[model samples]
Target: MPEQDDAEREFDLKWADNAERKEPSARARMLAARWKENPPEPQPFRADPDPAGPRRSSWISTVIVLGSVAAIILLLGYANFRAPY
Candidate 1:
């Protein structure tokens, strides 16, 4: 019983000492120091206008929309002015 208690006490002390330590690697600290001395500059963000002409998809989409509108108009006109049976 006494030996078990001593073992538990030693384990607890070892864990506590390990938990309090936080030592970074020598190489990591040196690199961080160098970065701080000569930090990188920020880049500018821009959305330059596209130099290419209009796309084919845009023209196709416009044609499809116009055709649909014309078909709907014709359908409505025919339904309103149909000959009597």
Candidate 2:
């Protein structure tokens, strides 16, 4: 404490306090230590060939939804023209 600067002493004290107050899981500790030693590599960037093109699943769902809406509108129109119950 005497040899260390104010900031270093404060950091050591804070580190000790955190270590005492919170105990990390074995897996968490291992991962954190590993990351400190060797960080994971970032993925290489790749530009999309067709960013504006619709995805198959999304396009199909949209078509189904539009068809359902059209059917409902037609049913309501037909009901409106029918005789009162």
Candidate 3:
């Protein structure tokens, strides 16, 4: 048990020393320095125009309007021809 403990302690110390000796790589230091010196610029926000805005009447709407007018005219003609109460 004592031997195992001693070995573990030595390993831990060696690992800590190695970690302390290691320096940040050049790329990592460059990125960190760049971020510190020039932070990211804020992006401008934009809204998309409404897709349904100001559209011309489609063929379907025109056909429906014409059909409604014709139906009203037919109804009026039938009512005129009927006997008066």
TM-score of each: 0.33, 0.35, 0.35
Which candidate order results from sorting by TM-score in descending order? 2, 3, 1
Query: Candidate 2, residues 28-84: lDDT per residue as tens digits?
Result: 999999999999777558855567865578879999999999999999999988958
Candidate 2, run of 10 with poorest lDDT: 47-56
lDDT by residue (1-85, candidate 1, tens digit) is: 4456888899998887888677889998998999899976664577445557766788799999999999999999898799566
Candidate 3: C-alpha RMSD to true structure equals 16.4
Error of 3 at 71 (Å): 0.2
Q: Estimate the lDDT of model 3.
A: 0.84
Model 3 residue 70 lDDT score? 100
Model 3: residue 18 alpha-carbon error in angstroms = 79
Ordered list by lDDT, greatest first: 2, 3, 1
| lDDT, candidate 1, at 2 | 47
Q: Each candidate's lDDT (Cα)?
A: 0.84, 0.87, 0.84
Measured with C-alpha atoms, the lDDT of residue 49 in candidate 2 is: 56
Stretches of candidate 2 above 4 Å error? 1-33, 44-54, 57-62, 83-85
